[model samples]
Target: MIARSTFSNGIVLCCRSDDDDSLLAVKCIDIDECPTSSLVLLQHEVALTRTISHENIHTYSSVWLSKSRLCMSSLFMDYGSCADIISSHFKHGLPEKIMALILYEILTALSYLRSVNLIHRGVRCSHILVSKNGEIKLSGHRNMIELSRDGIPVKKVHDFPKHDSSMLPWLSPEILQQDMQGYCTKSDIYSLGITACELANGYAPFTDMPSTQMLLEKLNGTIPFMLDETTVAPLIEDTSPSANADTEKFKSEMIEAAKSRKFSTAMHQLVTDCLERDPDMRMDADQLLKHPVFRQIKGLSKCQILQPVFEKMDPISKKASARVFQEQEEMMDELNRMSMCDVEWDFQE
Candidate 1:
C-alpha cells in the first residue's frame, strides 16, 4: 500500500515514495472542481510532456484517471527547484560556471520546444529543477502553448486570467498587456533573462518594491535595481580591511566580466533584450542559442528531447499564439520607433 502525505487540489501522496526512487510526481486533478477549459489544458500539458523526452525537459511518466481524480505522471526531481537553492544560498550567488551550465540546459530545452512549435510561457528560475548530479530540467510544461494544430490553423484562447505583473518583471511587455498573438518564443527568452538575473543576484529584480510600483516603473521603461557602481562595489568588497587591493580589483573585474550588452554573459543584457519595450527586436530561442555565451557551454546537446502530450491540435492555443504574436509585433515596432525618437529628441531637448 502507498502512503499518502499531503493532499490538495485532488493531489495526494499515492505511495511512500522517497526522493530517490524512479517514481513520478502524481497530481490527482479533479475535473469537476477545475474549469473544463483548464482540465483540457492540463491534459495537453501531460501529452506534451510525454511527447517530448529530453534530458533538459522534465519527463512525463504517465497519466491516468482514478474515480473522480485525474492523476498526472511526471519525473520526480529530488534536488527541489532553483528557487529553493537561491533561497537557501541567498548570501552568495552560485559560481559562474554552474550558472552557465544551468542556463545552457534551459536554453537547450527551450530550443527543442521551439523547434516543435511549443512555447514555455513560464521560464522562471523556480520552474527549473536541478538534479543531484548537477543536471538541469525545465519543469512546469503545463503553461506551454502549441503554435499549430493538425493542418488547419488553430484558434488561440485569449480568455485566460491575467497574472500579477509584479511576480515576473522579466516578462515581455506584450505578455503583460495581454497581447496573445504577440506572445511567442521570444516571450520565453525574456523570462529566461529574468531568471538569469535572479540567479546572479539571489533575488528577483525590483524585489524591494511593491509589485504595483514595480509594474508602473517597468511600464515607464525604467528597470529597477540595475547594477551600478554603488551596488556592485558593496556586493564585491570584502569586509576585512586586511584584504589586498589587488584582490579587490580582481573582484571588480569578475563583476565586470559578468556584464554585457548581448544577453550573453551579462544578465543585464539579457534583461535588456528580453524586456525591451519592443518585441520585434527581442531575440528568439534559436537566436539566443546562437549567442557566444550559450555556445561555449560544455555537455550541452542539440537533440530534441521532449514531445507534446496530445498529437491532436487544440484550437484555443493556435488562435491565441497568432493573436498574441501580431499584437506583440505591432507593440514592439511602435515601442522601438518611439525609443529611437526619444533618444534623438532628448538630445535636442
Candidate 2:
C-alpha cells in the first residue's frame, strides 16, 4: 500500500502494483469494526456502481471478501474531492473557470443518470471526486433512487433521502416541506445549484445556522448566490450602541469581504436558475448543461481547463501527499503489532 486514510466506517488504501506501479484506491471495511447496516450499504454501493457506465461516474473495478475484511477497489483519484481542494488550496473557493469545468462534468454524469431513470440525490462537493488527469467523477451512490418501478414511471417521490442533518443545506425546499406534491429530478437540480454556490463561495449557505433555522431559511425562499462584489448588499448605517448595531457591523464586514472578489453575470444567473424556490421553475440537468456559464470552458479538455489551478496547487498537493505517507507508515507499524497478522484469506475480483 502506498498510503492509507480512515473514513467513517472503514479505511481507504492507496495501493500500487509491484510490477507496473499501477495505482488503485481500495476501500476496506474490517468486518469486526463495521456495523452490519454500514457494511450492507457499502456492498449495495458496489452493486449499484458496477452497473453504471459513464466517464464522469465513479464505478468499482472489483469487490471481494478477504478473511474478516471486505474491500472494493477503483481507479485512484489523486486530487480527491473538490472539498479537499477547497480545504487545501482554495479556502475561499475555486475560480469561476475551474468551478464551471467541475459543474460541467457533474452535469454530464447527471444527464446520463437521468437517461437511466436515476436520481443522484447526493450531489455535493465531497461526493465529486477529481483525479490528477483532470477527470471528474460523481460518487456517493448509496442514496441514489430510481424514478421508475417495474417499468412504470413515477413522477414524484415522497420518501426522504437517508442522510443526516448535514445534508439539509443541500436539500431542496420541496423535499424539506414533505408535502403531497412530492419531488422529482428537479430536486437534484436544486442541489446542484447549492453545490455551485458552495464551489463559488468558501462555505455552504446556512451552514452557520442551527438545523431548524437552516430548514426555515430554505423553506422561506432564501436563496444562496455566488459571493461577489455585485451581489453583496450595501451596508446600512447604524451608529447606536445596541445589539442591532453589532449585527449591522457584522453584516458590513461580510459585505466588504464579498466585495473583494468579482464574478461574471453568467455565474450569478446560473445559480439563480438552479436555486428557484419552485421546482418546476428550476433548470434540469440538460438545461444547465447549455447554460452560458459553461461557455467559458468551451472546447477545452478538463485537464487543459484546470491546468493553471493545478499549477498553483502543486506545492500544497506535495505537502499533503507527504503527510499522508507519514501517517500511513505509522498506521502500518501499529497494525504490524496486532495479532490479526496470522489471518489469511481468499481474494476475488
Candidate 3:
C-alpha cells in the first residue's frame, strides 16, 4: 500500500500488488452501529457487483467488515474519467467517432443493468471510467435502484429522499418536473443523451445557470444540438472561380462542406431520440445499442487512442520523483525494522 486517506464517513487506501505493481483501491465506509442508509447502500452495491459480471462494470474482488468499516476492493482505472479529460484536454470536444465508441460501451453496461431491472440514476462524464486497455467501466452506482418485474419502481425513491443537485444537468426533464419522483429506467436514456452532448462539447449545456433555472429550461426550452455543428473547411479541389459559377455554385459548396462534417446524420437523429422530452418516446437501452452511431465505431481499444492524451498529462518532475524515492526508502527501512512486516523477499531494489 502506498497511500491512504480518511473522509467524513470512510477511508480509502491505495494499494499495489507485489507481483505486478498494478494499482488497486479499497473503499472502507464506516457505518457506526446502526442500520443506516449508508450500510444499506453499501450492501446493495456489493450485491450488485457480485451479480453483475459484465466486462464494462467494475467487479469487487472482496468485501468484508474490517473493524466497523465495510471495505470493498476493486480495480483502479488509470487514465482518469471523461470529465477529467475534458477539463484538461479536448476542451472544445472529442471527435464524433470517439464519442460513439464511448456511448456504445456505456449502453452495453446499461443494457445489462436493465436486464436486471436496475436503473442507474446517475449518468455523467465523471462516472465513466477509461483504462489503458480502452475498457469503459461504469462507476457511481450508489444511487442505483431496482424496479419491479414490469419495469416500474415499487417504492417512490424521491418522495422523502434527497438527491445530489449537481446531477441536474444530466437528469431528465420529467424527473425534475415531478420533484424527482416516479421515474423509471427510461430516465437513463435522457441522461445518456446529455452525457453524449457533454462528451461532444466538453460540458453539458446551460451549466453556468443555477440548477433550478436549468430545469425550467429543460421543461420549456428549444432542443439543443448535441454535437457542435461547425462546418468543415471547404475542399479546394475544383475551386477555380469560373465566369458562370454564381450563387448556386456557392450554395453547393456550403452543402458539400456540411456533408464533410464528422458527426453523422444518424448520430444526430439518435441523440434526438434519446433526448425526447416524453418519457415513453425515448429509446431503450436495447434499441440504443443498435443505433447507427455504434456501426461507425472502430475496433481499437481505449488505451490505444487515449495513451497519448494520458502521457501528455503525466509529466512527473525530477524533484518529485526524488522525493518519492526518499520516502520509499524510509518506508522500506521502517518495514525492515518492524518484526511484524511480512514483505516478499524477491522485491527488486
| Per-model TM-score versus the true fold | 0.63, 0.83, 0.72
* Highest lDDT against the true fold, candidate: 2
Ranking by TM-score: 2, 3, 1
Q: Give the TM-score of candidate 1.
A: 0.63
Pairs clashing within candidate 2: none
What is the C-alpha lDDT profile of model 2 across 1-349, one tens digit per residue? Answer: 4334333367787777565786788888788887776667666677778778999999888888999888888888887888888877776678889999998899999999888778878889988998888999998787777787676989888878654456778888988889999899889889988999889876778776787998888888988888777776523333444358755565565566678888888889898998999998888899889999988888888898888667766633455579888999999998988786577876976
After superposition, candidate 3 runs with Cα above 4 Å error: 1-11, 18-22, 30-40, 149-161, 179-181, 227-262, 305-323, 326-349
Quantify all predictions' global Cα lDDT against the true fold: 0.60, 0.80, 0.70
**Looking at candidate 3, what is the lDDT of residue 286?**
93
Give me the overall lDDT of model 2.
0.80
**Model 1 RMSD vs true structure:** 22.5
Q: What is the lDDT of residue 228 in candidate 1?
A: 39
- Tens-place lDDT digits, model 1, residues 1-349: 1213122245533322465564445667677777766666677677777778777998656677788887765655544577766566432344444566677779889888877777787788777876444567998666677765564434332322243333356565556666556456666776787777777656566665676776677667664333433356555565654257865664565466445312333544555665665667778776766665644454544221111101222222243457778999999999877755456434565
All models, RMSD in angstroms: 22.5, 7.4, 11.4
